[model samples]
Target: MVNKVTVESLTYEQLAKVFDHAILKPEQTTQDVITGCELAKKYDAKSVCVKPCDVKQASDLLSGSRVLVGTVISFPHGNSPTAAKIAEALQTVADGAIELDVVLNIGHLKSGRVQACQDEIKAVIDACHAKNPDVVFKIIFENAYLTKEEIVQACQLSVAAGAHFVKTSTGFASSGATLDDIALMRANVPDHIEVKASGGIKTLDQVVDLLNQGATRCGSSGTDKILDEFKQRRGL
Candidate 1:
């Protein structure tokens, strides 16, 4: 974990490491993905979170770099069958994705299918681990569509399922990551299970604020703007 407890104490490199440069939009073209990968490389981002189809390309582009490749499973909607989700997790890993952000079954959770939800998450993570033990797994709660209690429940489910992180929002929802949501998620999960703030994170301030509030990662498409602002703020 990052030892820099406060945002002011964080260096430019540390701030860059907190970002997972996102390129997950459905309409993004192949060229857009290439440009996004270049941006991630330029910023030394921790990872490039791309769509499933783009996983191989991203992995290939970032092969010699430290920027890892990550892809989403079940995506904006978490309504896929457990078997399909597991297949996607396996395929993405095979395509060189080192991290997987899986969307939780929002309907199941809201409808009180707690055991089913936890079971699916466990099955997917277990299968992915079987393929690659070092592949990181994150559970997306899509908090914009859930109640506070539901968010807490999702956190518990993620922990029970042994997820490495609990994420907020999918960026296709009505709203995205909020400070209140980050704080709430931080309080609900254990120290080992970190929080990730995604969806609508566009500025350096938002990034720093979320990290200070306990989010170890922030997903954003605005890598250039955020990192440029960081340099400007410090006159670098």
Candidate 2:
């Protein structure tokens, strides 16, 4: 495939745009969220993905900066009730988060409850859109848990439900984002929607490889170290 390690494909400019550092945890304090947002600003990252408890702090810190505030809903597990997921998304947004990553109900999708899965996504999307048209909604399908056909189906459902992006994993599942998954997601999704590759993206090469596979956004805590490595290699 494409060699994305250089400044050519995933350029310094583009590299900065791909980051969405995940700072989701109970032990993480407001200061941690603020520092994460600051780091995003310093590195030119797109956003800092925080948990619900820290969304407000992240939003406040990132307000005047280009770094956006993102929060996860129904989190690492897609087994939560649809109502719970909806409430999480709504409350997180009301808490000042501009971006949301909601886990799709894998049970529904895999059990051939196609309409149920679609409806859940649509309801959440509708709720977010109604709250504020500018709010971004990304649906996480946890690709590692799915077969190839299931992955394609998930992408189609995400697009049909009006999600802004189809994300790979929550980093707490059987697997995280993979090149094969990204390729499948990119090829299956419509051009209007973007692909997000997350989970276990620790090195610079992983980021480059994912981007080359059509991942427009990346979620990881390794952003700073990875970028540092890139800059050092470039003698910048």
Candidate 3:
């Protein structure tokens, strides 16, 4: 669905339709997460994604609001073990995160440890589900490390492993989400799955472009700037 964004305040109907939104910083203090929630609440954002370390505070600040708490697991490198990743996801959720982003096993996947990578993803998903069956699972593939073929294969694998979304990057890779990567994921994912275009999505135009390419969500720290543009554009 094309995001019908305007400068006016967002609604539950509108927020559910929102896929692109803000992520908190690791260096930011608890006050920052509170501030982020206040700002996101003003727009009724779908979620305020923060690093795992901040999930507890963000969740507390955003409690009673419609916004969900998002946290990343395993992160950009994907060198962490399946057990460690599951543990991280468990900790994140226990800390009040409702949406989990797990990094795919890139080294394993690239080295033809296909089943290993798939099993890792599945384990994370299962563990997260066990904790909170309602928790949403986004599997980051760090797409810049992949070729087009790898991106497609990863998308299929993510779907097969029961991930809710196929994410592009951790925003720490050499490159972030690309139209090509989102397009590939959109094309390859099963009907039940979604695509989240993360990393390096700084501008409103870039976010719109990602949505056009079938990105259902976006993770970025530049959300304030984007909202500013939206306000300016709509003269609200």
Candidate 4:
């Protein structure tokens, strides 16, 4: 878990580390991935959240840098079969990804199949750990498709399944992370399990606001803009 400090007290590097610069758009190409990794290194962001196919390339590019490589599983939708998700997770870890952002099985969760959802999440995390126990796992809730009660359910299920973090959105959904949802997620989970606010988080103030509200991480594609604004604010 990150240190519990006010956002105002965070220095420029501390603020930059709160962001997981997203490179997961489907239309993005290899060049985009390269550019994204460069941006992550430039700002010393936490990680570059890339698509599954770009995991190896991203890992290679980010190797020896403070920015780690993170990839998504089952992507915007969490409807993939359990076997496939596990396979994808293992492969990404093997390709040198140290962090993973996996989408929860939203359909199963909403259909009241809590046990199945938990089982799948645990199974995926287990497989990844079997390969490398240090690989971090963040469960993406894609909150746009879920109700408040369901979101809480997702948070509980993620914790029960041993997820390291519970995330807000995939950014491909109709809506993205909201302050209300971030606070709600933070309130629902124990302190050990962190909350990540993603999707449409584009400004430094929004990042600061989310951090203040208990989000340990925020995902965005506009990392350069946010970090540049931070430098301007601090006159770095």
Question: Can you give the TM-score per candidate against the true fold?
Answer: 0.97, 0.94, 0.90, 0.96
Candidate 3 yields a Cα-based lDDT of 0.79
Off by over 4 Å in 2: 1-5, 8-10
Which regions of candidate 1 are displaced past 4 Å?
1-7
lDDT of 4 by residue, 1-236 (tens): 35545435779888888889999877899999999999899889999999989999999998899998999999889999999999999999999888999999999998999989999999999999988999999999999999999999999999999999999999989999998999999999999899999999888888888887789998999989998988887778
**Candidate 1 lDDT, 90-148, residue by residue in tens:** 99999999989999999999999998999999999999998789999989999999999
User: Tens digit of lDDT per residue, candidate 3, span 1-236?
Assistant: 55554334443344234543555455777777778878777766778888788888888888898788888887758888777888888999999998888888898888877778888888888887887899988888998888888888888788888889989998887999999888888999876788898888878778777777888788876666676676667565
Question: What ranking emerges by lDDT with the best candidate at the front?
Answer: 1, 4, 2, 3
- TM-score winner between 3 and 4, please give it: 4
Instruction: Supply every candidate's count of residue pairs whose N, Cα or C atoms clash at under 3 angstroms.
Output: 0, 0, 0, 0
Candidate 2, which ten residues in sequence have the lowest lDDT sum? 1-10
In Å, residue 80's CA in model 3 sits off its true spot by: 1.3
Please give, for residues 1-236, the per-residue lDDT of candidate 2 as tens digits: 33545544445767887888889766788788778888889998888899987887788888888888899988877788878878888888898888899899887888988788888989987987888888898889888778898889889988998899999999887779999999999999888899999888899878878878888899998889988888877677
Best by lDDT: 1
Candidate 4 global TM-score:
0.96
Q: Please give the range of 10 consecutive residues that has the lowest summed lDDT in model 1.
A: 1-10
